[model samples]
Structure formats: C-alpha cells, structure tokens
Target chain A: MPRASLSPGAVVGLALRIVDEEGPDALTLSAVAGRAGVATPSLYKHVRGLAELRGLVSGRVLAELTEIAAEAVLGRSGDDALRALMDGWRSYAARHPHRYSVLVQAPLPETAEAGDRLVGVMLAALRAYGLEGSAAIHAVRCLRAVTHGFAVLEAEGAFRLAEDLDESYALLAHMVVSGLRTAREMSAADSTPGR
Target chain B: MPRASLSPGAVVGLALRIVDEEGPDALTLSAVAGRAGVATPSLYKHVRGLAELRGLVSGRVLAELTEIAAEAVLGRSGDDALRALMDGWRSYAARHPHRYSVLVQAPLPETAEAGDRLVGVMLAALRAYGLEGSAAIHAVRCLRAVTHGFAVLEAEGAFRLAEDLDESYALLAHMVVSGLRTAREMSAADSTPGR
Candidate 1:
C-alpha cells in the first residue's frame, strides 16, 4: 500500500478548490480522492463521508470567517468596527464565493461554538456602537441579512445594473453604518434624550 | 398507452410539494413523476428536463411571490406598505422554503425578462412609499436580502433564541421599515444619490 503525503485538511482544502473551480455540484468523493492523490477508501478513513466531508469544509470555512471577522474588529470599535468586520465578511465572501455558499448552507454543529464566538466578537464590536439586548441582536441579524444577500446575489450575478456593483456595495455599507448610528442614538435616547 | 391526468404544472406543483415535505435533496424527476401518478417519459413530455422542471417550480414560486407582494402593498403607503410587503415576503418564504431557496440560487438568463418583471413588481410596491430610481432598486435589494437571509436562517434554524421567532420577525420588519424610511429620507435630501 502506497502512503500519500496528504492529510485530511489537505483533502478538504482540495475539495474546496474543486468546488470553487467547478461549483458545488461538481464535488464528489471520488473526485476529491483523485484530486488529493488518495484512494477513495483512504479519503473516507480521514473524513466520514460526503456529508461529513462537506461538514468539515463548512466548519473550516466558518472558522476562517470567524478568524477574519475577529481580526477585522480587533482594536476597532463602534460603527468603524462594524464596517471593518462587515468588510472583512464581504471580502471573505468575494474571495471564496463557492466556499462561502458552502458555509452558508452547511450545518456544522462542530462550528457552533466557533460561530458563537464570532457572534460574540460581532456583539462586542457593536457594543462600541452602543446597541445592546434586542437592538444588538436585531442589528446583527440585519447586517447578516444584508451582507449575505448581497454576497450571494453578487456570486449569482443578480446585479444586472449598468452601473458598477462595487459602488452599490460601498453605498450599502454607508447606509448600514448610518443606520447603526441612528439605532445607537435611539438606544441612548431610550435612557435619556435631549441631554 | 396508459395515460394519467398529470399536466406539466401538476408535475411541477407535485415536485414543489415533494421539496416542501422532504427537502430539495429528495426532489428528483423520477420521484416527481411518481408523486404525480405518471410515467417518467410522460413527465418529460410536459417539461424539458430536470433543470427545466426546477426552473418551472422556481418561476411559479416567483410569480406567486409577485402576486402576494403586490397584494401586500395595495392601498398601503410608507412604513405601512413596507412592513406589509416585507411581512408578505417572509410569509412566502416560510410557506415555501424549498422553492424560495431554488428561486434564489437558480440561474436565470442574463436578459431574463421574468426577473425584470419580478423586480418591477417589487419596485412598484416600493414606489407606494415614494421611492424611485436607485433608491427603489436599493430598497428592493435590501428587502430581498433581509427576507431571504432571515428566511434561510430561520429554515436552517440558525437562530438559537428562546423567544418566538415570529416575535423576532416582527422586530425585523419594524427595523427594516425604519431603515427604509431613513434611507428614503436621506436619499431624498441627497438629490443625486447614485446606485
């Protein structure tokens, strides 16, 4: 039996590359084995099955996203942190569109702790902007909706506009920033207005 | 020849039913034909192929969504209209999660006139709130993102809240209405905000 230098991480990484190059439908266990220069059984030895492999890829992608998001918010606060983190998110989506989709759809319980950590990072970042409780939760969800929708649409070429999409995204980021600012102000005013 | 009463629309409708009951991964041409009480070849007589069948399902879903959205905005204006329409969007999503997802991810033609019609319908609804041009476009996109994201996450059980999701959804709609109003007011003042 010939031993391959490839690890499970390498196999999953190559699988992601295949997905990125050929779309998710093109991802097959045999194909991943071939790409990773391993026997099909050898591939399964490390990963459980296609679903498990997909889960691994999803977890890795989510962890990467969480790290990038955390880095983006580090040393930044308020609206600036939100912008930075959101930009990090958009950039991650842009750079890894297929993997991003995988992350979006794949349910990785293993990544739940990591995802929660990422959310904590987001909540902390928004805390600088003064949104807490339901407002904070609402802000995070709204941002996720806006960012996920835009990224997925962009990936699918849904922006059939004559104008550049980048411009629209920039404007979107601005509006989101301003909206968060308003929400923060309102949150403060709830305590004491006209001070 | 054994003939069944299944038509193309019935086939697609049954396929949507299968999707709703068993999920997209469970949807297959054979399964659709089986559910429609027809032969596979007879099913093909009504549709082009699997992709076409999926496209038909997506088209019907989008058409229904357009009608519901139009109805939600009727005789309503401003925040009232926005909330009603967005609520309608969410209801559509919740009721038809599988088809809604297919609608989001399916590839439409670059010059897909159907999508244009859908967008036009949404824009008309926004116009009830006095939005025009790119603001109208942006509002539609934002609304779509929020609706799609929330629906997707909701269907996927992404939210881990102890409270009722309907409560969160109401808050979501309220927040979107607020944001849209702010965007409308700000865009109006800018006088030359570009898409």
Candidate 2:
C-alpha cells in the first residue's frame, strides 16, 4: 500500500475517528496508521507517539467543547445561562459519547488553559448569582458534577425508567440554579449582622 | 507444581487484589491463576471464564457498596440522610478507587436488585423531602450525579486547587439540600390556587 500523505492535524483527525468508532481501548499506532493508509513508521513523523497523539486529540476535543459552551452562554446569564451551559454539555456528550469519554480521561495540557477558559465562561455566567472566588469555584464544581455525572449515566442508559430524559435534565438544571441561589443567600446571611 | 486449593471465593478475592493493585486492564484469567498458584486450566474449575470472573467481581463490589451506603443512611433522614449518603459514596470511592470504577462500568445484573436496593435507600432518604415517583427518581439521580462525579474527579486529581476538599464537599451537600427544598417548594407552588 502507498504511504498516504499525513499531517499532524490529519493524524489527530484519524485518531479521533478511530476512538469515536472503536472506543479508546481500540486506539493504537498501527491501527491508526492502517486506517489512514500510511505506514506505521511514517505515522511517527506526524505525531511523536501514541501519548502525544492522544494529547493532541484531547486538546482538540476540549477546544471544541469550550467553544460550543462559550457560544451557548454568550448572551445568557443566571438561570438562563446555566440552562444553556448544561444543555451544551449534555448535547456534546450525547453527540460524541466516545470523544467525551476520551476528554474526561485524556491527558489534558499541563497548563489546562482550555479547561480554565471553559470554567471562566461558567464563572461569568454564575456571576449573575453574586458568586465569586471560592464560592464560585464550589458552584462550578457542583455544576460540573451534575452535568458530567448525569451525562455519563444517560449515555450508559442507567436511567432505565420510562420517564422522559428532557424533563429529568430540566429538573437537574433547575436544581443547580436553585442550589446556586441558595448558596448566595447563605453567604449573604453569614455576613449579615445579628440573626 | 500441585494445583492450589482454590474456591470461587478465593478466585474472586485474588481478582479483586489484582484490580486494586494494577487496574482492571491487568485482570485476566492467566494473571489470576498465576497469583492464586493454580494453572490456567485449573482456574476454570473455580470460574467459568473471564466474563464470569468479571461478573463475580462486579457483583461483589456492588454488594459491598450497597451495604455501605445502606448502613450510612440507616437511622437518618432529610438533610442528615442526604449528607450521610453523599459521604458514604465519597468514602467508598476513596477507599476503593478501582472497585468504584468497576461498579460504575460493570455489566450490573440485569435485574439489578443490588443497585435497586441502593436506590431504594436513596429514595427512602428523599422521602423526607416529600419526594415520590418521578420526583424521587430525579432527586436520586441528582444525588448520584453529585456523589459519583465528585468522587471520580477527586480520584483523578481533577480538582487542582488548594482549597480543602472537606469544605467543598460540605458546600456541595448544602447545595443539594437547598436544591431539594427549592424543588419541593416549586412543586407545592404549582399545585396551589391563584397567586
């Protein structure tokens, strides 16, 4: 077989395709090269090794997710922004289950800039609730927990009841917004004079 | 070499050890047999095959988790029960990371009695908040999402900030309780007559 022309971007794309179709466990250098119609030795010219290839794919996926999330909450705030962000997360996971799994487990960049950017957008949205610093961080973590956990279970078909998922997801979003508001209220009460 | 005296229980014990020490990927019949001082063929006398072994391990892990969670919520209700349940989940995951992962991904029993038993305990806890039917199910999913997501991320060192985890967990517990209260209030409002 002729060695196909492959760039680093093309290599990452092929790797992503492989992971999406066959799951992360099925990803290997030889398999990727085979799928790309390139020799195993020639593939190394694009990506340093399997680890680098995975990292590139992870970075790309995170970048894309962050972009989508940013756009979702662009003109929204408070509960509306929260709903948009949550919807964005669930939709991304639903549309790309394997890639989402990879994103969760993949070795993100050492700087984690892409992740931080996504979190920054979340913080901006939560600002409408008067959260900042540690409070904001905690709320962000809670939001992430709800979104990631629900998405994983949903993808795995763990919610086996006949209930509509949209209703369930909406309830979850409402719960998070309510939680954030309560956190803000409690924080306010703590700083107030006298009971 | 004489074949070791290996019962099914002992085989499962050894498999659990392997998974705890080297992760699930390292778990195999040959590896378990080697560790158990039995030939690979002799291992079949105890477990039918790899699939059965994994199933046994998964069953055992789920059973242990369910028991732990049940005990934690016993003699508790409302926010207290919720806090205990969340702590129970986080503690179990911390104490046995590998087992927790298996529980999440394992092909749980089709009947899922053990899982149902665990959910039953969660439902009992949620009942204190006047939740039932789909409401209870949604609340339970929310609880599971927070606990599972936090535990998974914590185990992976995903939260790199310097903040104390105990504080963060407390905040999360407060958030969940608040969310439940708000959800209950919303449901109540929806049922009430003219504003």
Cα error, residue B174 of model 1, in Å, equals: 4.3
Looking at candidate 2 chain B, the ten consecutive residues that score lowest on lDDT are B103-112
Q: Model 2: which residue pairs collide?
A: none
lDDT of 1 by residue, B1-195 (tens): 546777788787898889888877777998987877767777778888988887777777778887888888888877677778878888888777776766656656622566677677677767756765666666777666667777777666677756566655655665566666566555465576563
DockQ of each: 0.38, 0.51
Tens-digit lDDT string for candidate 1 (A41-160): 888777888988888887888888889998998998876788798788888888878878776667547667767877787788778666556767877776767677777776666777
Task: List where candidate 2 sits over 4 angstroms from the true fold.
Answer: A1-3, A108-113, A184-195, B1-3, B108-113, B185-195
Model 1 quality (TM-score): 0.87
Error of 1 at B168 (Å): 3.6
lDDT, candidate 2, B30-96, per-residue tens: 9998898767989888888998898888888877877888898899998888889889889988888
| lDDT (Cα, 0-100) at B110 in candidate 1 | 24
Tell me the native contact fraction for each prediction. 0.24, 0.42
lDDT of 2 by residue, A1-195 (tens): 334767999988999999899977678999998998767988878889988888888888888888888999999888888889989989998888878777656664532776788778878878888866787788787777788788777766667778778767866777787776677566576579995
Q: Could you tell me every candidate's TM-score relative to the true structure? A: 0.87, 0.88
